[model samples]
Structures are given as structure tokens and as C-alpha cells.
Target: MKNENRRTFVKKAGIGIVASLSLSDIPAVMTGSVPDRPEKQEVFFTTGFKAAEVTTDSVILWTRLCGQEKPNPVVHRRREAIFRHPIDFDEEMPVGSMDGGVKGIGGSVKVQLSGGGQILESEWHSADTENDFTVRIPFDRLKPATSYRVTWTAKLPGSDALHTAAGTFRTAPQFSSPDAVRLVTSTCQYFWSYDHDERGFRIYDSMRRLNPDFFVHTGDYVYYDKPGPLGTTIEKARHQWHAMDGWPSLVDFYKGVPVYMTKDDHDLLRDDVHPFSPAYGQLTFGDGLKLWRENAPIAGKPYRTFRWGRHLQIWLMEGREYRSSNQDKDSASKTIWGEEQKKWLLETVAGSDATFRLLFSPTPVVGPDRDRKTDNHANKAFETEGNWLREYLSAQENMFVVNGDRHWQYVSVDKKTGLTEFGSGPVSDAHAQGWDQEDVRPEHKFLRVKGGFLEIAVVPSDRSAAVIKFIHRDVDGNPVHEEAFSSS
Candidate 1:
């Protein structure tokens, strides 16, 4: 059979079989040597395979099982649990864990060291029903600054057929190591059925060629409110995620390198969403958060920090959660990071010893908003808190901000404080609605309203100062602009 026909046959034959399969039956199914089979046949993997939350000693591997007959019962139970206990509104419990009976699609994960050829095979790790058959397999006790290959296998529940996926990733160097770290950052990916151009996601191919240590997806990973044939519900959200995962370029990019993701307004709901805002059409904040958590391989608290060698320390902040209502007045009480997260941010910056502290903001922190909206930290609505943060950062030795959400790319510097910020352009060529190149601020060192990504190279130095180079590359991997800064 042809490739597409074979995939169709395997998908049709594999429906509703993931739950009944045993781990022991996967090896034969993978090798196409199942006992009593007339001819060799292989199982096909689902579209949802990627890696995330990589660290010096660990990395999270993920994949989803496709061709399910119906939604998993655990998903319904988890939805019911969210409805019963709306944790997003509850201040006491900022986050909640989903747990229930064992409704898992059995699978196995194998990790291999690239150079040493040491193979670490894991026992079956279930694709949980609550997570839409998505499984996250973590590889721990790994060496720092090393490369590894990860492979996942699963058998069709009733049949002796298996599906497989493979990916690669490199861990961060130790905190004291002087190794350099390369990172790519971008955001604002809006996929609509009407927009069928293949070039929309071609940037991933260029990103893979650069071979960055990791990619930081600032937000808009998916537009939950965009009109699609998929119905409005949590299931629709899962379908959207699966659709994005199925893209060939995206799959290839993730397989080459790991990603660090943060959620933005579009990814959560409609644009400019606030904490207490009403639901966007039929999707509630609770369901949106649940779907976001279920799809990604996040390990701990969403807002956390990562230390890359002795030169770079990255702070990934949560912009949506704990934010005050958009209708609130601009005061000290009107917060974005909430009290606890704000405290942590200040403490982490004060205590950090790295050469450069890079803060990742989902939205721009310094701006000339085309619209007079205060949803982002740049607006006057956050003046009080923003001023405090600016003063604190200015007092520090070496600090910078990297932001997304704006469809245009620009490098802006605060005139008074001398703090620099880099904005990663949109993933698609489309500009933000009601905004254009004319709206870019006067302080912008560079601005472009096209599709591109930011590549930052952190080079450690024998002296106290470290050199950081920012190369802005277009979709085809050509450097359109470049800038360098030193951190002491």
C-alpha cells in the first residue's frame, strides 16, 4: 500500500484500541513481526508529539494517541471538578491537579545518549484520558549540556500493531559552567482554515537550521477564540491543539530542539482578556486554563525561573493569572503578577548572580500602544507597578526584557533608565488588527512588521561581563538585523 493509504488503514483499524493494549506487545508491533500475521504492517503515530520544560538534568517528552472513538471519561470528570471548584477565582488555591481512575493508553519511552550510546528504557507510561491521551515522559538524572534521542512506542489495544515517534534535545549547562547558550523566541501564531498557505509555518524550518539550545514561545501558541469548524468546548480546544501538532514543520522543529512556553491573551481566550472578564463566547477561563495545562509538558509552577550556565538567568512570568480586572483603576492594588508572584520576581532578581538576567514578558513592558488599552504592562493602567519595576530594574547591574504579543518586531530602550527590550515579531505575516508600522515607538532601535524570530547568543567571558548578541532572522533564515550588548 502507498504511505497515505497505509496510514488510513492503520488509523481506521486502530480506533478505540489504545486503551486495551499491553506494554509487552509493543516491541513486536513496532518491528512489524507480530505473531501469526500474514504480512508486515506498522502502526502510525498520532499528530501530538513534542518536547518541553528542558533543564540541565532533565527534559519532558510528550505525545498523544489518535483515532479514539470518544472523549475519555476522565476528561468529563475533570471538567466537572473544575466547575464544582473554580480554582481560578479561588485565591486560596491558585492551581489544581487533576486526578481520577486509571483510564490510560499504555505506552513505553526509550531515551538514548547521543555520544555514549547508553539506552534508558522506561516502563509503560499511560496516555491519560484526562489529558486527551497526551503522555509526558520525563528523563531525569541526565548529564548537563548533553544531547539525547527520545523514542516513544504504543500498541493498538486490541491488535498487535504499534505507533512510534522520535525526537532530540540538549540539556542546559550547569549553573557554574561557562558554556554559551543560544535561544530563539517568537509568538502570535494564528491558524485559520481559510488561510491555507504553507509558507505561514516555514519559519520553523529556518529555526531548526540555527540549532538553538531551546525556543521560547512567548504566547498565542493557539487562538482559542478564532472561528473554526471545530465546535466550541474543551474538546474543540483539544482538537485545535492536535491540529497544530500535526503540522509537518512544527513537528520537525520540536523534534530537533526543546521548547519553553508561556500563555498569552489569544492562547487563553479572546484578545485583551482580563482576570474576571466574562467567558469568550462559550469558552470559560477555567476550561481554557485546563486545556492549556493538558496540552503542554509543564513540570511545576507556570511562572518560574531557569538558570543557564554562569551567564544567563531567564525569568518566565505568568501574565494572565492573578491579574486584576481590566476595569480596575491604575493603583498599587491593581496588580498583574499578583502579590506572591510579584514578591518572587523581586527576590529572584535581587539574589541572582548571573551576568545577565533576562525577563520574559508575554506582552510588551515598554510601549506606544496603538490602542489605548491597559491590558499589557506598558499601559498607564499598570503605571504604579510598572514604575516600581522600572526603578528596581534600573538599580540592578545587568537586566533586559524580551516580550511578545505585538505582531511587529522592535528593539526599544527606556530613555531615562537605559533598560533595553526586544520584541519578537509574529509567526505569521499578518499584522495585528488596527495596528501598523507607523505605530512603532520613537525609541525603537529596529522595527519590522513581518514574520521573523529572535536568536540570542549568550557568550560567557573570563571577565565579569558577558557578551549577548541578538540576531533578528527572517522566515528564510537570513539575518535582517543584528545588535550586541554587554552585561556586567
Candidate 2:
């Protein structure tokens, strides 16, 4: 099972959502919301709710007040997919309004928290048209490692339509506590390659079943450059987020699980984008940044770390905002992580006393990637800084890397430094590619050119050691590969 055959099985059977998870499997979770009929009937999108950036005592809750129930249906034409893109298009494409567009409405929302002994409530928060009809209410100073349920009600300005939804999440444990943590990580999601027309991506349903403590989306959540109609304008870019995040699979999974999100090339503007990168049509880099902040729950510094007890600490790296151009000469000064963030990473790694440290980067740091790739630390594009980072990481006693940009899943140990990395692969089978299944490298312990995700579990084995296990699961939630490491 620890090979490419597992994917071949998925392709043969679970190619359709009806075969994997039938629509009847989902109970209508949102109260007072109309059920989506089999006619592919138009139901009002509650836009649901998601938990993000959970800390020991705080979590940010986010939701959008959409004017419509869901994104406008996509327009697909079979004859005009001329570009090397995922979706088909017509010669005379409509670009004025958006294709899969769902606009934010002017409204206010009320939220209540009931988990600990004390029930907390909030005053009505305005979600105006200026902020994209989104509202974020933060609850702080709660108990650590505790489960909390959040209930919110959204009301449009004059309409009696009140949308009520509830979701639950657990905060991280205290740094010194001996708590075990389980989480799933995935990346590289393309809109047109959705396995189910209604569910969006089948993998979301799979990951939801694991019932992890949290989820990490390494990046490429939306393709600002790829088609489903290209996202060349700010309106189109905003359309990409709602269209992808508004899916039933995604909307439902985020209901119970909190998530940590990172941005990669596609998340920003286009492929290989840096600070000096040009605009994608009328969408400038700054505009992209603003839109991301509006949609995402993370507000402060983009790069940060979180600890899930004495056993595990994870550093999530930011690769886009402050990197030298990919075309720059490879030198010590060239960097994928800017000097400030790199310094912070080094200091945090050295100061942490956790049993295991996991570095999650949006791009690969120890990759056996294709030679043509130039945007990651594993490429010749930034080899000098990459080598320094690798050597430094190798010096750590119990450290591992989990990265997301690559389409294929693999586990590779750096031959020169003995550092190990796990690539989480793409979000679906149709979206997986970019590597040859037969061309396994000498450094690879496992390699699969198919879509899946990586799940890691941290458990206390004794007072002083912990067991960290990595399971690579296919889209149907079947484990294809498993690897384990023990604290030194």
C-alpha cells in the first residue's frame, strides 16, 4: 500500500463523489437554511463559519455576509481550453462582472461563545460593503486545550433573513503540558479540478474524518493565475476565494476544525511572485495582499509559530512577501525568507525546548524537485541561502520539515545533510502531476505522483520522549504509507 498503486485504486473507483461520499451522507447542518435539492437547486449560502489561528487562550472566528447563497455557477465551454490551464474558456470571454462571483452584503452579525463555565457574548459587529461584508470577532483569555462552541447570527440591513450557524474548535495546550496533538496538512488546490461538482474537493471530507486538533493549509488555496476564468482583476481574485471556500466540503469541514493558513505564489498574484512582481492584469501585489487579509482570519504578522504542548512546536514560514526575485543571482544574500523572518526562525529554533520541532513551509526546503523549478529553497534559484538553512536545520537534534508547493507527494532525506522532508502533495487526483512515478530518486524513501495529504500525530511515550508518526492518506482516507520517529 505504500506506493503509487493506492492512487490507481482511487482513480478506478472514487472518481465520482457519488461513489465515495454520497450527498445523503451530509445532514443539513445549518439551522433554518433551506436544504440543497437534487435539482442542483439554488440555496442561500450561509457562507458558514471557520475557526482560525487558535492559541492557548484565543481564536479568531470569521464569516462573510454574502449577497447570494453561493458563487454564481461557472461557465464552462469544452472547445476553448487552448492555454495550459485547468478550466476551459470561450474566445470571447466575459470579464466585466465575475464568473463564479459571490459578493459581500452590508450587514451586522452577533456572536456568542459557550464552552467554559462562563458564557461570553459580543455586541453586533458591522460587516459593511467596504470590508467585503466579512466579520471577525476575537475571543481571548479562555482556558487552554479546551473545546469551545461558537454561535453566530447574521442579518442583512433591512431583511428579516437571519442566518444562524454554529461551529466548534479547541485551543492549543499550554507550552509545558504533556498533550498529544494530531493534525492534517494539504496544499495546491485548483478550482477546475474539483472531484465533486457539489463538494468541491473530496480530500476535505477525508481530512474532516481524521478529526485532528487543527488543520494546516500550506498554500495555493486559490490560483490567481490559473483559469476557471483567469483572476486578472481584484474582483476576479475575490471571486476565486469565495468560489473555492464556499464549497460544501470546505464550508462544512471548517465548521468544527480550526485552521492555520499560509500564502504561496498563487495565493498572492501569480506563479513565482515576489515583492517586485508585476501585477496580474489590473490586480497589483498590494491589492492581492489586501484581499487576502480581508478573507483570511490571520491579521498580524504573517509568519509565526505555535506550540501544542511540551512534545511539539511548529514554525509556519512565509515565503512570498519578502523574497529576492527568482531571477536574482544565487548568492548568500539571496533569500526565500527575508532577513528578519530568517533571524526569527533561527532564534525560535534555538530557544525551543520541545521534544520535536516541525517547520512547515509553503515551498520545499529539501526537495528533489524538477530542475526547471526556480521559486523554492530546494531549487538552484536560491541555492546559497537554501544550503545555509538546510545545514542549520540538520544541526537540530529532532527537527523535520513539512512542505506544500509540490504537486506530487514524497519523503526525501537530504543526502548531504540527512535532513528529512514530507511533501503533502496536491488536494485532488486530477490536480496531481509534475513528477514521473518511475523516476524515483536515490534520496526518496517514498514517492507518489498522485493527490493525497499528510497526517502527523504526536504522542507522549514517556516522561521524557514522544513518538511522532506521519501517515500519508489517499483521498478516500486510506493510509497508503506510514513513517514514525522517536525523540532523541
Candidate 3:
């Protein structure tokens, strides 16, 4: 038989068969300097490479594997098996699952202190095809108010060559500590193509200079609606994610700083999509939700809270899941946050002792949406719940709402409740559509329609009070507007 046929037979037969084969049975090519077998090339990471869910002592590292060609058949078969028998998190249905045809790569992660001391090294962890060849490495028992560097090396199947990536993150400060908390927030990043614009995502470069503890991507991180119909299948959605990750700017940004992300209507399927929205082509809300969870650094549900020292408490709300249809009747019973999340929000607010409480919403809770009647809290669709929330927030001191979805930036206070709300403008200048200029509102303090981000600084003051400074910076990191308030 030819050398190719012999090698194929050898691969199919067990290693025992290979040992039993005679030298004569093996073709002459096997004995030559150039082996008859072809070597599998190493696969590298397409994107991801981010840190999330960072706490005083723990942070989750995320990454995805990619290759030049389709994955090996073995990888697809194994991934299908995992899909059939999905694993749940704490008895909840699996929020994410990998589809077939994605390669699974084995890897190890090494974490070290910023100054170069090794802290933790993980054993071999497979970036299994089951999770779309994505891996989350959790580093625990870390010190508070500390920075760590994480590095990963991945080995391709049947190959000795390795691929690698590295990132850094700083853990949250200890509870009630006097350490200042710095955070940056932005939304509406609609980069359909990497080279669509000339600047090529320069905003991220500016953001890296600011060196905030973490970034809050309120929503529209990926625009699934534009450029075409939303992806319906796992593979398609995963492809979109890989394409977005291919961007050099995003890759560099996530590698340096951790991010907290939430999804909006565009990221899901269409504008104002709910659980019951009519399917576009084969795409459904459930598919979008799965893709969002799978690609994000989060493990289960997106709604969660983060506390930084005693000065800052962040409530990241899930405005999409469990929301009523936008076409639903605008009655008192109509809901956006649903009952469970609303209850949790109220209870969490009532019990929190932090000096500054920030409610991060995917959509503006205090907005008119450029005179459009939409499903946001400012619209009549959710007036009843909106009023209740405004009233509840009115009674609470040192509370603010920071929102995305609207491309423009503005700081507005609730007319009745006096609750202040800050809007983080779009990250892409091209997506800064509608509201060419900030509209004059009864509570409007600052308005800028240009693309920029919002930065919040919480610093200790004399006595028991803390000063919170809100500054909006242009895409190049120059401060365009600023607002300040005191919290006691």
C-alpha cells in the first residue's frame, strides 16, 4: 500500500496496531527524513481575551480559539456530544452551549502579580468545542486592591506548537476602604466592519490611557441587526463574535482592561425586541440571548451587582430579559424589569449602605428617545413602573442612573423625583445618529452629541462625605464636560 494509505490505516488502528506493524509493512516514505504524516498546524485565539466579574479576591478570564480552516471531525463530534448533554449552573438551564465544527484546544494559564511574582498556575484546561472553544479561567484567593497579569498558552490538537495571549486586571478594593474607585462607562458601539471607518476604533486607545479599574459597556457592544439579519444559529452568532474580535483595537483594549457588558435591542435581534417578538428569518430572542451569554464573560444571568470599597455600588440591570412586548398595552401591570428583578432592585437598594449607588441600564430610564415613543422607561409604555422607580429613587440619597442605547450624551434629572441620570454616549462616531445636538430638558445639566465615554471618580472627603466627579471625555480622552456631586 502507498504511504498515505498506510498512515490512514495506522491512524484508524490503535497504537497497539502501530507497535505490531513490521518495518516492511510500513512504506519506505515513513523511514525517510521527511515523515509521510502531515503535521496539524497550531490554532490561535480569534478574539475574547478579557477579564470580567472581578472582585476583591477573584476574577474570571475569558478567551476563544480559532483557526484558519474548519475544525477537525473529532472536535465536531465531541462538541455535539456536549450539546446533547448540556451542563447546568446551580440547577439553572444552560445559558450557553457550543455547536459543532469548532476546534477544542488544550491550554494552561499562569497568573502573576503586576510586579512579576507568579501567583497561580492552572493545570491543563481544554478550550473545549462544547463552549465554542471558549475558556474561562477563574483566579481566586487574590489580594484586594491589587493588579495581576494573566497569560495563556494553547496547544493545537496533534501539534506541539502553541499560541498565547496575555491580559491584566485590578481587583476591587476592600469593603469600606478609603481607596478611590475609578470607572469608565460607554455604550452603542456599532462596528459592523473593521475597516469601515478611517480612525479604526481609536477610542479604545484613549480609554486604555485613562486606565479605569473596569469598563462598563452598557449595551450594543455588537450590532447584530445592522449589516444584515441577525444570526440564528450558534455557528453564525459565533462567527459574528469572531469577526468583531478580529479588530485590533478591541483586542488590545480587552487585553489591558477588564469589561462589564450588557446587551441591548440591537445586540438581540431588532429594535425593542422582547421574548415574544416575531422571529426575523430564523432568528429568535432566545438565540440572541444564548449568543450574548456565550460570548460575554458572565456565567449565567447578566443582571448582577458590583461593589467597590464603601464609596461605589454598581447595579447592572438586565433590561431585555423578561421584558414585555413593546406592543403590549401601556398599563400599570405592564413591566420592563419583570417582577423578580424589580423586587431584587428595590430590596438591594433598601439594604445597601454604599455612599454612591449607580443603576446601570441598557436603555435610558430618563429619556424621550428623540421624541420617539419607544419602550424605554421615559416612554408611556412603562410609565407606571417608571414612576414607581423614580419615586423610590427620589427618596434615596446619592443614587444615580447611568444608561446607554441613545447615541447622544446628556445628564437629566427626573422632573418629579429629582433623580439624576447620566447618559454614556456612543463609542463610535458613525453611530452617533439622531439628536445632532443635546436637547434642552427641564433637568438637563450637560449635553454633548459627540461620541465619548463617561468617567466616574469616587474620592474620600473630609468628615464622612465622599465626592463623586462625572466627566465626559471625547474619543481622544480630552474632557469635554464635567459634573460633580457630594455624597454623605
In lDDT terms, which candidate is top?
2
The TM-score of candidate 1 is 0.80
Could you give candidate 3's per-residue lDDT for residues 356-473 as a string of tens digits? 8999999888774655666789888788888888888778889899998887788888877888899988885555657747356667888777788889998888435799999988
Give Cα distance to truth, residue 226, candidate 3, Å.
0.5
Each prediction's total of clashing residue pairs, residues at least 3 apart in sequence or on different chains, is 2, 1, 0
Total clashes in model 2, counting residue pairs 3 or more apart in sequence or in different chains: 1
Taking every candidate in turn, the Cα RMSD to the unseen true structure, in Å, is 12.6, 15.0, 10.6
True-vs-predicted CA distance for residue 428, candidate 2, Å: 0.4
| Model 1, span 1-488: residue lDDT tens | 89999999899777546546776656686657767845433334445466678788877777776553222221211112211221232222211111111122434333343423557777666654677677677777888888887776776545656566677788888888888889999887754421224422777888899889999999988776653312256655665575566556776788888888899887786677877878865788887888888777787788989888889999998999789987788998988889999899888988889888889999877755555878877788888877777677767777888998887778888776777788878775543333566666667888877778899999877746679998888767789888888774
Q: Write the per-residue lDDT of candidate 2 for residues 1-488, one digit (tens) a residue.
A: 95699888787775564456666664456234576674322213356678899999988888887767766665563322222244346423544344556666677788888886858888889987677777788889889988988888877666676778788999899988888899999999977777776787899999999999999999999998886666788777777787787778998999898999999989889998999998898899999898888877986889989888999999999999999999989998898899999899989988999999999999999999889999998999999998998999999988999999898889999999999999998998877888899998988999998899999999897767899999999887899888999895
In model 2, where is the ten-residue run with the lowest total lDDT?
77-86
> Whole-model lDDT for model 2 versus the true structure?
0.84
Which candidate model has the greater lDDT, 1 or 3? 3
How far residue 90's Cα lies from its native spot in candidate 2, in Å, is 4.7
For every model shown, what is its TM-score relative to the native structure? Answer: 0.80, 0.87, 0.81
* Model 3 worst lDDT run, 10 consecutive residues: 74-83
